[model samples]
Target chain A: MTNQLSLQQRIQMAFPGLAAAYSVDGLLHYRVEKSRIPELTQFLHEKARGRLALLFAVDCRPLAEKYEIQYLFAFASDHPWVLLTIELAGQDRLFTSITPSVHAAQWYEREIRDLYGLIPQGHPDLRRLVRHEHWPKGTHPLQKAFPWNKTIGRQQADYRFRHIEGEGVFEVPVGPIHAGIIEPGHFRFSVAGEPIMQLEVRHFWKHRGIEKLFEQQTLSTAIALAERVSGDTTIGHSLAYCQAAETLLHIDVPRRARYLRSLFLELERLHNHLGDVGAICNDTAYALAHAHCSRMKELLLQLNDRLTGSRFLRGAMAIGGVTKDVSAIELSEIVALLDGIEKDFAELESIIFANASLTDRLETTGVLTERTGWDHGVVGVVGRASGIDQDVRRDRPFAAYDEVPVNISLYRYGDVRARLRVRMDEIHESIRLIREIRANIPQGPVAPAAAHRPQPGQWALSAVEGWRGEILYFVMTGEQGSIHRCKVRDPSFVNWPAIQWAVVGNILPDFPLINKSFNLSYAGNDL
Target chain B: MFRILKKSLKTGIVTGQHPHADQPAESPSQAVCEKAMPFRQSLTIREVDTGSCNACEMEMNALANPIYDIERFGVHIAASPRHADALVVTGPVTVNMERALKDVHKQTPDPKLVIALGDCAINCGVFKGSYAVTGPVDRHIPVDVRIPGCPPRPAEILKALEEIRRPASWK
Candidate 1:
């Protein structure tokens, strides 16, 4: 691990024009001129080999004279995060666009334009990223001026989806209202017969103004808000929020609480992977595999209910540590349950692999090339499937992940089968992790006494390797220990765009299978 | 195939017999159980998620699994509202999804039952006061039944569905 002094020195050496810089919890925080943001970010990406973890804007008018844009860069090899913040002054707030060099900044810049009304001067596509047409012009939701419960009467406007003009090209516009029990997202597929030529997705149908809602709540209540960012990713989002709060407060979570948090995270990964595997099979008309997988997933949910009060593992996390603790008997019971689940999973795995027809449907159905995956900054299982060898748990160890090393599963095939293979490998790995955590169960209190209020003007970044991918939460405190801005970057937000690339050559019927393989959360992205 | 058959036979008859026999004695909240006796037999449900966390959807999905097997009770999840006997909605109604929710409700035939699953649909549970949220499902559309939880368990969902299926006199 790179120590704070050397990390700060390395940053200063690389960017000579840095105005001010400091290090907190080993993360290097630097402030640079607005004009130098693009150049500095490009240098960090290319020279420092820093991955763009999160890019968000904060309406810091209360604390400062201007708004601030924060760019979080993580060096996986060095395991340190460098946050570059730029302040925009004057009425017409503008900053140089980094999207031309860094492709991942496209959505983030557009979102900034939509929510905080900050203009990324050269961003290619500045169409509304968060606010729909219903939102009145000049009204930015994330700005502190916008009331949390302010309503706008419905306004209608046509979203001009990209049109592929050619012979025999027809467009199939699917839901904001889907047939199945799934969240709403609009998919515009310009196709020739069955093969999809071009695809465009418009989400935010389920947007509940989650970030704006966070501004209204205190630190403790924000945990509840974070848990619902996406229900399946309850632990991942809440833990990221809690970790960010803990970091800002400088609270050292007990070793046992860390272990329990890791355990819950793995358990969440287990159930979700099982469910996704089954859903993929179901998409291929392999109902039997789905049936067995569903049974196993249900069992995991039951276990979660028995352990935590909620099946989805909500209310299990606090700002300082976790709210619940597992006794020895309950831990043993979980171990026994895992034993049974593993055996059943192994049998189901054999059956799924042996079935040639099912595998045929999955293989090469939705191919997301390695180049596109990297360019788009895909993370988690989808990224691993495309051979992007990055996992937050392994690279930037959070919670107890540093103690228990994760064996990352990667595949270069970039197809549905490869995605499924990655998920299966991860399931086995998660089961192993759970067993290891259960055996080495530490003895201590789950949480500290009551969490104390964080100091004003403190900012912290937390990232968790959620079941879907890397869930990043950036928290900054403002006047009298209240949250100034809390920006959540769910893995789905980054991975959803990659799906457009995955479905290009595939037929329309394979869209659902391709979608299920990615399984990006609509609520997570919409938030 | 033979192995699958053998496994199926080994795990025989896991489906619950909630319709024929009363579920094993457990304290049933009058709010959920009193409503449960009416809708005992046939139901075609169309679920619309306005802006749920997807936790309710997971529990709803579990109702079709082997243990909870809602199909045996003649409860089916219809893909179209036109064919559905009931509209099962989840989540708080978001501004964008309000149109679709009302459209689905309108398309469902008369004498339709609307069951709001999860606390979001019941009263905008956790997201009660967000600007983007129009309100709970009932604010826009009349909901005949409400299954409450951050996300109600599968058993609770099953009971609520069964309750709505019963004749009006039973209720």
Candidate 2:
């Protein structure tokens, strides 16, 4: 850790001519020239040894002449991200896309193309990833001066996916609706019989302009929106936003409140992972494991209701502090619950993993290699399974996470089984974490956010390792109390590509198990 | 066939209430949990998705499920705007959804109850200031209740709904 900090300091010292540092919380943000981004990122990717995860651009519409395309790059090197913003004016809005350089930047580049109307100079497969074709011309909503009222967030289907051509590679069109109770998303699967040739995920069913809405609401209220980005990962995303707000406002929640937030965050992980585990079992047609996991999850959910007055453990997290203080008694009950649940969960897991039939489908299926995993910039269990040891909790701790140690489980399988195992391991880790936090649960004022309002122009980036993955939030408020703009990037946005990749080499029937294993949030990404 | 006949012979009657063959059919808490929203007045609510993906819908569905039993709070969700009193909206009210959102609020009856359910609905929490969304529910509609979370748990939603009607219900 010391070597990393000093090495970064040396680099910053050397780069005084080309780049500078902006520290947000404990994470360092080094802004470099656009021309130097690839080199800098390559240095970080190679030297940082895969600490680098996602690279995406955001367009900042200033009153000035030039358009700003900012590149955000993070590393697993236990160092802060180096953000490089380049000014694109005239015809130069097109910079050479980084898709060729890093695989993960592929989707981010396409999204930048759609929202900011900037094309990556040489982006491969540069089609409309989102914003179906026929969006009214001369207006990119994210662009500054695009009148707020002029923007119409319409869900229009546009353009056909370019399919891979050849004999026996027939197209299998499914969804906008599926057999199960799932969200609206169309998947274009090209296959020869059961084996999938290629899968193109057509998202944007529930794409409401969440970012645009945040442009107008108060910080406290906007939190409600963040929490809803993905229901299951509410605290995951909420913790990110809340951390950003608290950091931006320079508000430090009470110690007890911080511990409380962490408690809910871990609890959120427990429930979601348990649910995912159960869902995967169901997909594999393992009724015994499926039923047992669901029952276990039900017990947890019911316990959550008794402990926090909510089944999904919502309303427990506020901006600076949590909404309600979890009592010592409840904490003890949670500990007991975790102990019992962990035993049940492990028993079911062992039985499933040991079973020959279950292992056959899960093993060697939906293989995403190390290169592909890094390239897609996948996060959470999916990323970990693919040998990307990027957990926001372990990498970048927020709230009371700094004090609480977390176990980041990593694997190299990059398949459905790896994903499932990562989730299972994470649940076990969550149980351990719950027990620890309960033992060390502090006492103090649980509410400290609304007490002191932050002065504007004091921007802060607070990130948390959410259950799904790393949830990143950037907050910029005006000199007054109002916010100018804030960007919420859930890991789902980056992980969706991995989902597409998972469909490769897998039978059509096995897609359910594969999808369940990853279970990327469509709504969270759409927002 | 003989095994089936033998199994049937163990039971006295064909129409016997069960897992409770040994005792009563219901647990004590089950009665109250099974009852519909325990209020005299039902809060007419409209569910709007400003920019959420649908995790909220999962919890929203669970509200009416036998377990959570959201109807026990006199909170029946209304489909159309004109028929609603409270707005139980999710998502950040992304740019494209701005118009429909405003219209929904306008069409709703007076003294409307608005709830910003889930993290997205309350603050556009993460999607803050993106180009597409225009809300946290409060931007387009007056939010009377706020259930914070990505998708507020059913219990949280019920609590938020309860908060909205509490003052009036007392009156």
Best by TM-score: 1
TM-score of each: 0.95, 0.77
Give the TM-score (vs. native) of candidate 2: 0.77
Residues A2-61 of candidate 1 have per-residue lDDT tens digits of 454565666678776664476655477778877788788888877766778789988877
lDDT of 1 by residue, B52-157 (tens): 9899888888888887998888998898899887888999999878888889889988667788888899889778888899998888998777777888888877
Worst 10 residues of 2 chain A by lDDT: A50-59
In model 2, the runs with Cα more than 4 Å from the true position are A9-16, A23-26, A50-66, A89-92, A149-157, A449-458, B1-52, B60-171
Error of 2 at A435 (Å): 1.1
Instruction: For residues A1-527, write the lDDT of model 2, one tens digit per residue.
Output: 67557656756664556545565434555655667766666665566544344444444444345666555667654555666667676556777776676776777788777767887877787777657554555456666567544545445555678688888789988755444446556788999988998998887656666666666677777776676667777777777787777766667789998888888888888877877887787788875565456556656777777776566666677777888887887888889888988876766666677678888888998888878777677777788899977777777666677898887788998888888888899899989988889888778899873555666545566567878888777776754555656677777887777788778878998887888787877787776
Best by DockQ: 1
CAPRI category for model 1 = medium
